[model samples]
Target: MKIKRVSEFVSIKRTVENGTDEQLLAVKAIIGNVKKDGDSAIRIYTQQFDGASLESFTVTVDEMAEAYGDIDKEMVLIMQEAAENIRSYHQKQLRSSWMTTEENGTILGQKITPLDSVGVYVPGGTAAYPSSVLMNVIPAKVAGVERIVMVTPPNQNGKIPAAVLVAAHLAGVKEIYKIGGAQAIAALAYGTETIRPVDKITGPGNIFVALAKREVYGDVDIDMIAGPSEIAILADDTARANEVAADLLSQAEHDERASSVLVTTSESLAQKVAAEVAKQLAELPRKDIAVKAIADFGAIYLARDMNEAVKAVNELAPEHLEVITENPMELLGKIKHAGAIFIGRFSSEPVGDYFAGTNHVLPTNGTARFSSPLSVEDFQKKSSIIMYSEAALKENGAKIATFAREEGLEAHARAVEERLK
Candidate 1:
């Protein structure tokens, strides 16, 4: 980690990936083929990319049972508990259909409707993310979405990870497909013969998957295109150097592009944390990845005061923000623009990533300035409700007609005027 004065520090710059011309063309062709050939196209791509030739893509009851048997009983219970926590938290976000009635018999309101269906694309290469399963699927389930389909690539032996399957089952997802990459995204967006089209898609994936989602966006809604993970800690001298280093590394190990930053008022604490980060990096299982991430994106800034530190953090707008000051709550009102805020030394970043009720699917890069974390609202749609009685229309129709006429929409004007007559 490099140490610098707050005035000299520059925020990490991570550009959003726009796939190469070759990759974009490939994704376009994949989507086109899936649209034309349907299930057969998916089968061909599955064999080529995943190296598994599966006659069937759907996970069967027998396979689900086998997955349950394969995972440890204790781990299964932990997943169940995590699912419950996620469900409870998102249940609070549900909005009821509401209407406001006027004395002139006018009724206006908003109707909240869950999407007809949703496709969750879980990444399948190298690592298994049962945590991703819980974070993505549980919100849709809580939002009352009836059809939730999950897709992940299969291993060379044509097998999905047991933990992934177990997490999906716990999250109430019945439809699981053993296919992945750009082709799986195409199938989800356009629908193959075996798979039905979904109203929206949510989940994180590699660059190809992100490109596919971008290409198919208008046809079907998609969650935001996510970037690499990030964490920014606002700590004071009272904060433990070891604990702060560990929290920063939690996100650094995620990827070489991931960012880990610390902004503090205490110069001594800043030096200690930088040294501690180096010591701990040597012990991390993903040391090579973390080392590059820390080298490329990590930093420690010494601020003149708490106010200066807070301002720097606000400018950074990290995906995850931890407040390790003497009084974390006192600064809450001043701090703004983070995807998720972890208060105090005890609330480490991973708590929200796994056990805590909050969703870990957060805005990355500097998107936290304007965007939000994945939530139940992403799985639901809002419909404005307007019911105008004869009396109300007679009173207001001429005004509406005039507005429409001013816009040069004669048909719209006439349509409203006809009702008035």
Candidate 2:
């Protein structure tokens, strides 16, 4: 990791947006074929990519029960606790339909409705993410989504990970499918003979899945076009080097493109953190991936003072931001952008990733500059509610017609004008 002065650090936004043309073409072709051929296309792609010959894509209730029983009893208990925490946290985010009545009997408000069906795309092959299953599924359940379908690549033996299936069941998700990549997104976006189309898709995956989500945006709503994971720490002299190093490595191990940064007022602390990162990197099981990530994207920014450090933190707009300073919450108001903010040294990034009761599926790259974490709101749709009494319309119709006429919309003007008569 490089220890650079904050003034000398260059922005890496362009590097984060680097998606290849070939990947786009391949993803587009996969989505197109899946849209055209349905389950048959899914089977062909599953065999070609996942090395599994799947005659059926659905995971039946019997299979779900068997997977739940197959997992260790202790692990099941832990997942149940995690699911409860997730449900409790997201339950706070559930919205209600609201309307306001005026003196003139005019009524206007927003109607909050959960989607009829939603699909959660879980990534497979490299890792097992039961945590993701809990994070994505619990929020929708809290929002009262009627049907929740989960899709993931089948293992070589045409089986889903037992822990994943168990987590889904714990979170109250009954529909599970063994299709992945662009095909899964297509199956969820466009209905197939075996799979039903969904109103929205949420969850994270590889570049191919991200591209597939990008391609299927209008046909089906998606969470966001997520990039590589990133974390930026803003600290002063009060922060510990060992804790900081561990937190940075936590996100770095996620991908070679993942970024880890430290912006601090103390140059001595900067040097200490760099040394600590190297020391901890040597001890990580995913050392190879973390090493490349740290080499390519990790850095310590030595700010002249705390104000400058805060400036850099906001500029990066990292997915995860940790404030390990004398008074962490004091600076919370100053932070304008971050998908999730962790305060104090004891608040580690991994806590939010798994059991801390916050969404781990966050806006990556600099998308944190404008977006937010996945929540119950992501599974919700809002419709405007408007009602006007005859007297209220008579009072405002001419004004509305004149405004429409100003925009050269004759029909809109006439629609409002008709009410006047």
Candidate 3:
């Protein structure tokens, strides 16, 4: 890998913004079919894409119990601990309703209510992360969502991974279906025969899944249209090249499309890191993928100084940003756009990805500039409550009517005018 100017490293467009008409048309057809045919459509798509024909989509209690037994009991215990951490972190984000009474006796407040049901999509076909199951389900559970249904593509054997099933069980998700892709999204957004519709859907998938979420957004609320995983490391002279290389590979191994970038003020450190990345890439099991990702999207930058480095961090707005320096926390206030910031050498990216209490589901691409990570709020809605008193309305009626009249909204003015006279 070569070091480039930080300005040149940014992806030109939103990753989600670009999609071939053919792909979109194909996804649209899948969504339409699932909406029309329901469970039958899901079964057919599973057979065609996953190479598995399923008579039933729902994962039965027997299957879940078998899954728990199949996975290592030690791993299950660790997942339980991770679930507890995720739950504890998200419980703090739970909101409550409150009301206030003014001197005029007008009541105003905002009411918080959790969504009735939510669907979570876990990708299949060589993509599986038990950590994702914990991250996605626990937040919804903490938000008091009544139902958390999970959908995942089945392998050719027509089975979801045992780790995934075990993680879901520990996270308190009882409803899981063996379906995936655009059809599963349609089933979630618009109900099917066996699978009930959900108020919202959250989780990651391939491009088709992201597009499906984009298409079905209005029908059902979605968390975000996430893209490939990305990590940006802003390191100074004190940063270790080997440690930096390891962290970059952590995200790069995620997929060939994933992006890993380093912005450093030390030119020597940049060269050493690029070399260390090459050295370490040889040892990784996902070396082929990490190599392609590093070759295609990964970058190392030679920033003139820390100030210039901060500009690059804010520009890319990566899903994960690690600041490794003498005083990493000192740069926290200056950085503005990363989804999650990892400070110091010990606080590597994977720490947050799996074990850290922070939600791993983060805004990808440049969406971190505007969007946020998955949280309890994603599973809840707020309603504004306004109770107008007679005295308050009488005091402000003409003013409200005059304001409406100024905008040429005659009916709106009349609606308020009726109370004035």
Leading candidate by TM-score: 1
Report the C-alpha lDDT of model 2 over 329-399, residue by residue, as the tens digit.
99999999899999998899988888889999898777888888999998889999999998899999999
Query: What's each prediction's TM-score?
Result: 0.98, 0.97, 0.96
lDDT of 1 by residue, 64-118 (tens): 9999999999999999999899889989988899999999999999999999899
Question: What TM-score should be assigned to candidate 3?
Answer: 0.96
Give model 3's clash tally: 0
Model 1 TM-score (2 dp):
0.98
Off by over 4 Å in 3: 5-14
lDDT of each: 0.93, 0.89, 0.89
lDDT of 3 by residue, 385-420 (tens): 999999999999989988998999999989987887
Candidate 1's error at 116, in angstroms?
Answer: 0.7
Candidate 2: residue pairs that collide: none
Which prediction has more favorable lDDT, 1 or 3?
1
User: Over 4 Å off in model 1, which ranges?
Assistant: none
For model 1, what is the error of residue 369's alpha carbon versus the real structure, in angstroms, after optimal superposition? 1.3
Q: Report per-prediction Cα RMSD to one decimal.
A: 1.1, 1.4, 1.5
